[model samples]
Target: MPDWLSLYYEQPIELTHGEGRHVWDAEGNRYLDFFGGILTTMTAHALPEVTKAIGEQAGRILHTSTLYLSRPMVELAERIAGLSGIPDARVFFTTSGTEANDTALLLATQYRRSNQVLAMRNSYHGRSFSSVGITGNSAWSPTSLSPVQTLYVHGGVRGRGPYAHLGDAEYIAACVADLEDMLGQTAGGVAALIAEPVQGVGGFTMPPDGLYAAFREVLDRHGILWISDEVQTGWGRTGEHFWGWQAHAGNGPPDLLTFAKGIGNGMSVGGVVARAEVMNCLTAHSVSTFGGSPVTMTAALANLTHLLEHDLQGNARRVGGLLAERLRAVTAGLGLVREVRGRGLMIGVELVRPGTDEPSPEAAGLVLEAARERGLLIGRGGTGGVALRIAPPLSLTVAEAEEGAELLGQALHAAQDHMTGRRS
Candidate 1:
């Protein structure tokens, strides 16, 4: 593993197995999993539906590539197309979100005949070379070399930018103005503007509801495709909508969208959906070997079936609402907690220097370690790792939600006391 690869705690605990919302470590200690392996375990850990599908499919056949017809792949694609609102949408499977975004970038650039792209400030698309070029967060983007020239636009985050202090109406107006000005400065046409409806890796922060709808107008005028990176926000994780893009529904659907990380329930599965015209823009032949494997497709089909049949979206709304409220109430009086933000099952708690807006990355690290000690596992992210990311399995029960919140409260108090004593 790379030295830069992060472990959850100071003493990393290896997980042995999990069921529902709980997992056991190698030491036989159990934990209430709150991050769901960075939101990859969408439905639950070791869900029988998904395990059965994989078992049944493996018993039949395994390594047939895209050269042959695949019923599971075709069926999964059909269901995804219906869910994706792109007009005459075409689905192309990939193995990860990085590949999905890479494909989306390819489609947009070829369709528009331009390599220049617009991306939101503080947004994270993926880790691949092509995807990293458009990433707005300098922390996550490791290199300056790129295949495309990217213009970072405003509105992914509205809490600490040039337009942070403005009211909602004013913030929207300012971001839209910034977009217009940025477009005017471009010497050539842009291929597309890719954005995450809710900025996921950037502390799970969200812009005003209509920010993207407003940006969509400008992109349309310039013939720039709109690509929504729904890797972290899709599959009804946001609770209020099926897809994150629906939050900006006033602009209708995006021209292209990419998804991954959750649909296969720990199995690697990802793909891109685009309008038929854009998707078919590739004149050259292309194929992904492990992308639409029968095993993965079967798992995805079963997982999607489980999600819809149980209406986990509704569960996310009800349980996530309770969790968020409980979190806010527990941390309200703590000066170290800056804010509790995000929607539904996906949430971020930002930490700061007590009484100031300055980020406290150290405080976040302490809290993360403290949470692990309490047998609670969460995630840390943001430009400086100053936010605690909370995204548990959608199948989390009401009791589990309350228990996790209580554990988190204890963790926060412990973090606060430690930080204070160290300062003194």
Candidate 2:
């Protein structure tokens, strides 16, 4: 593996197995999995329904190219199309989020006949060449060389920006004005605006509600497509809405919506849902050989069924609300804690230096290590990696949420103590 491929912790532990919201490491220590494998294990770990579906499908057939008519693929696509809310929706499967975003970009650029694109500042779409081109996070985008000309827009991160001091309504207006200005400055009709509904890698930061809807009006006038990258925030993770874009449903759905992570419940399943006209814009032949493998589709179908049947979205709303409240109460007096914000199950706790506004990645690292010590696994993000991301499975129980919150509270205090040199 490349040295650039990073791992968590001062000494990373190998997870051997997991069930529900807990995972056991190679050292035989069990930890409550708060991050959910970067929010990929959406429903749960070792979910029996998904596992059984995978086994049953594998017993029947494992591999088949897109040339063949796969029932599972078509069925899953149908389910997604109905759920996607895009009129005359078309679904295309991919093996990962990067490929999904890449496909969306391909469709948008081809349809608009322009390579210029709009992306959100402090956003992360994917890691592929095309996806990276529109990624606004400099830390993630390694090179300036990109296939498309990307013009980044603001309003992704609410608390830390030039317009941070403004209220929600004012903030939205400012971002909309900024976007209009950028669009006017652009040379030609831009292909699309790709954004993470809630920035995953940027410390789970998000704009105020309805920010995208405001931008949609401007894009509509220019015939620019809106691509909502819901890789991390899809499938009812946000709790309040089934899809993140639904929060901004003042306008309808986006032209393209890319989803991955959690749909397969650990299986590699990703896809793009777009309006038929935009999706069919590709005049050339295209197919994902391993994109919608029967086994993965089966797993996704079973996983999705379980999610809906069990009303995990409602669970996310109730339990995530409790968890966030608990965390806020615990971190309220802590000087190192800046803010705790998020919706549903996806929450971010920003850490700053003691008695200062400066970001403290060191404090975040310490908190991660401390959380591990207490048998809780979380995640880190943000431009400077100063925010702790907590996103457990949608099936996370209220008891589990309480347990994880207590453990995290202890971890936060421990991190603060370590940072202040009160603990040697």
Candidate 3:
């Protein structure tokens, strides 16, 4: 209706620009951007160092195909690998998170030579070929869920899940058992177990304790590839760690790690870090033209440097801790909220589902609309669309965080009052 582009949402606003944690409309009205471009721009809009890197790179060579090596690309790749801690890991950059995940999945397939993929019901890795097959977001996968799609999408390996949430230990255990059974049935044909270290779009939450370890144990025994989608949770957003997998590293490292979002400080840069074996499999597996461009690599390098210099990881931990606590208290005693989940800057408010664990999509929508109306920009993600995502820039101030939570609390209150009207 707004005529910017053909889109799916009911109402769309014309946002002009964003800085730090806020954006403005064409009318010059400012609004807080808590959504952070769906969690990709967590470093905030037009970050100085990142912008400088891009501008400087633009003056030089923009890109070169994967056939030739570039210094910045090599340097950034090494940095990514070092932070990743995946032995002898290598990087292959992409322009977006979807492409990164897609490529990672491709590498897994080649390495294991198997077709089966195990994913959570609410997981969202990407939308690219085969990746969509692995993505559990209903919106992106409903039509692709046919029996035929299931086979190819399942990649000739035994397919399973949209498993139970991370809140249930029994369900978590069962998911591991289920994978074991599927692997057993297929005679070890299961190629990979792909998951978000902290499910971002599935609602920013980590699985119960022993969850990752449980899966790791099984996958280890079965020699299954483990892929961690850190698209939305990486770059120190989760506070306790710079990477999501660290939240459960007691289990072991992932075979492959995919990162996007804040890696290049809102610039279009993404990459996958893989162990030596997995890296070898990919180099021998296939190739891409724009995988690693000089321009993007320079920006990524600058971004990483800024993150370290500013101790952004530490900031995220401090501010995010405050944000999470205020969030829990803001929604306290509110019947419309069921829970608040996630770590660091990645937070999710679970709307009341009444008698079930399933969130109330209607309430969530109302909160998004209300937040936007109240000079705050928030968004929803999750199978039920009942999770209000609050992933702001790591540079956000404590004041901004408090203001955001307070506004969201007001909006949630309004949401509860207008729920019936919205439904009608």
- TM-score per model over all chains: 0.99, 0.99, 0.89
Candidate 3 local lDDT, 1-424, one digit each (tens): 4553333136777878877778888889898888777787767687888888889988988767778878998888888889896887888888888999887777887788876677765677776666778776776564465211222111111111344433365656666666666666664467777888777777775666556767788778778888888898788888788888887686667899998878876678888889877777655446557767888788888878887888888888999889989989888877788778777888888786443545688778778888888899876876567778888888889999899889998998898778645555
Residues 1-424 of candidate 1: C-alpha lDDT, one tens digit per residue: 9998867777888899999999999999999999998899999999999999999999999869898999999999999999998879999999999999999999999999999999988889999999999998888999989999999988988678788899998999999999999999998999999999988888898899988899989888989999999999999999999899999878799999999999988989999999999999999998889999999999999999999999999999899999999999999899889889888899899998776788999889989988988999999888788999999999889999999999999999998898888888
**TM-score (C-alpha) between model 3 and the true structure:** 0.89
Global CA lDDT of candidate 1, please?
0.92
Off by over 4 Å in 3: 1-10, 145-172, 282-286, 353-358, 420-424
The CA lDDT at 262 in model 3 is: 83
Clashing pairs in 3: 115-155, 115-157, 116-157, 121-162, 121-163
lDDT of 1 at 363: 88
For all predictions, the C-alpha RMSD in Å is: 0.8, 1.1, 4.2
Error of 3 at 248 (Å): 1.5
Clash pairs, candidate 1, are none
**Candidate 2 local Cα displacement, residue 268, angstroms:** 0.4
Once model 2 is optimally superposed onto the true structure by TM-score, how far is the C-alpha of residue 169 displaced, in angstroms? 1.1
lDDT of 2 at 119: 93
